[model samples]
Target: MSMLNEWQDYLPDFLDGLVVTLQLTGVSLLLGLPLGLGLALAMTARRPAIRWPATLLVEVGRGAPALVVLYFVYYGLPQLSLTWSSFACAAIALAFTTSAYTADIFRAGISSIPVGHREACQALGLSHAKELRLVVLPQAIRVVIPPLVGFCILLYQGTSLAFAVSVPELLSRAYSQASITYQFTATLTLAGLVYGAISLAAVALMRARWPRRTPTITAGATRPPEPPTRTHPSWETTSERRER
Candidate 1:
């Protein structure tokens, strides 16, 4: 009844693969995050000079299939003089490619912010950058967090594609086990369970920790109660009282 026995026996080997999968996912996200944000900002730029090229890059990146991107990075890159290790190249390529996607995530988050927030900041005499860092970005980043975690889960799953390029991550590990044991179905089932568990864990953890608050609470627009008596001693009130 307990699956702990399998883990107890091969815990170290599984851990090694788990560590590689986590690294592949983490490095991609770390590299992609800033790049995505910068790209999102650039795409949203008012200047056509900035917007056009950035827009092009975002569009092209989004348009291309991730697996194709991986293939090009792995198989195509070395056709030139440049050479890269399998793990390094896969990480770099996935990072840069997914950065484009993450940029869109952030861009949407940033744009979802209201004009009034910026105006309010302006009224307070905060500069554009300060407003972004202080008022706008905080909210946008919050709005983006759930989805970004969702994307991280996605990136975690996508690490399986690293097998295409020969990175010994979960998928590659499973493939190795399959070749030796000829239990491809069982091995792949285990891989699927690992990926599912990771994604569900991400979702569950984010929900438990954050559990998105209602927009009204964060917006601070709740009205105060009216005074019980407008003014007991007011002339109008006194006149009405005298009449009564």
Candidate 2:
């Protein structure tokens, strides 16, 4: 009966917590996506100037613990005589960590574009920026979107770490509300459910954006298909015999 009463007190506090969680998640995506894509381009760069620095950043962030990064930003920044609020530090560190992983995803997507297409672009006399901006990246984006959205969902789950830095995000707020209302179990259980729902929704969104692999048929379906190249050798042989 007492626990049931405690559940009643949670509605308002949990809603407030959820708002902060969404805000942090939004800020992370806004900061991380473009930066991640740019870093991905950097990884593909042939120049040591760009490649080495991007490589170093991506490797270190991906290698390090997110929580440690959080702590470093939250606690270590103050030591250098630069002040940042805990929420700002948490958002920035989380965004940085997310960008590191996203860069690799972007790099893979961009590089997987067929070599022949790049040569085609060069043969057509397209400039580097023009080729990428108009042709290469647009194709790569279709391949990248699903995984990036999945990564963003992973990112959304990660926002819970913001609580460690004193951000009043869902998990942290649950802690406060539970502590005060003595409904720790109920409060946290609901919070867990909320996280699960958000993840499920994000996954569904990813699935909805799936790329179509094959081109749609036109009236050309009634036309004869081209003969295979293996059979074309006989035609070449016939041509040579006629010449002789």
Across 1-244, the per-residue lDDT of candidate 1 in tens digits comes to 2345443434455567778999999899889889988998887777999999887987767666677777888888889866788888888877876777777778877777776777789999998789888987887786677667766776787787788888888888878877876766666777778777887887789889887665432344343211112111111234433432
What residue runs in model 1 are displaced by over 4 Å at the alpha carbon? 1-11, 217-244
Per-candidate Cα RMSD to the true structure, in Å, reads 16.4, 14.7
Clashing residue pairs for model 2: none
- Tens-place lDDT per residue, model 2, 1-244, is 8656766777677788888888888887788778888898898887999999998998877877788888998888889986797778878887888778788778877776766667889999999888899887987776667667766766777888888888988999789887886777888888888887988887767667664344222353332212111111111235533432
Per-candidate TM-score against the hidden true structure: 0.82, 0.83
Model 2 lowest lDDT segment of ten? 226-235
Error of 1 at 210 (Å): 1.7
- Candidate 2 RMSD to the correct structure: 14.7
lDDT of 2: 0.75
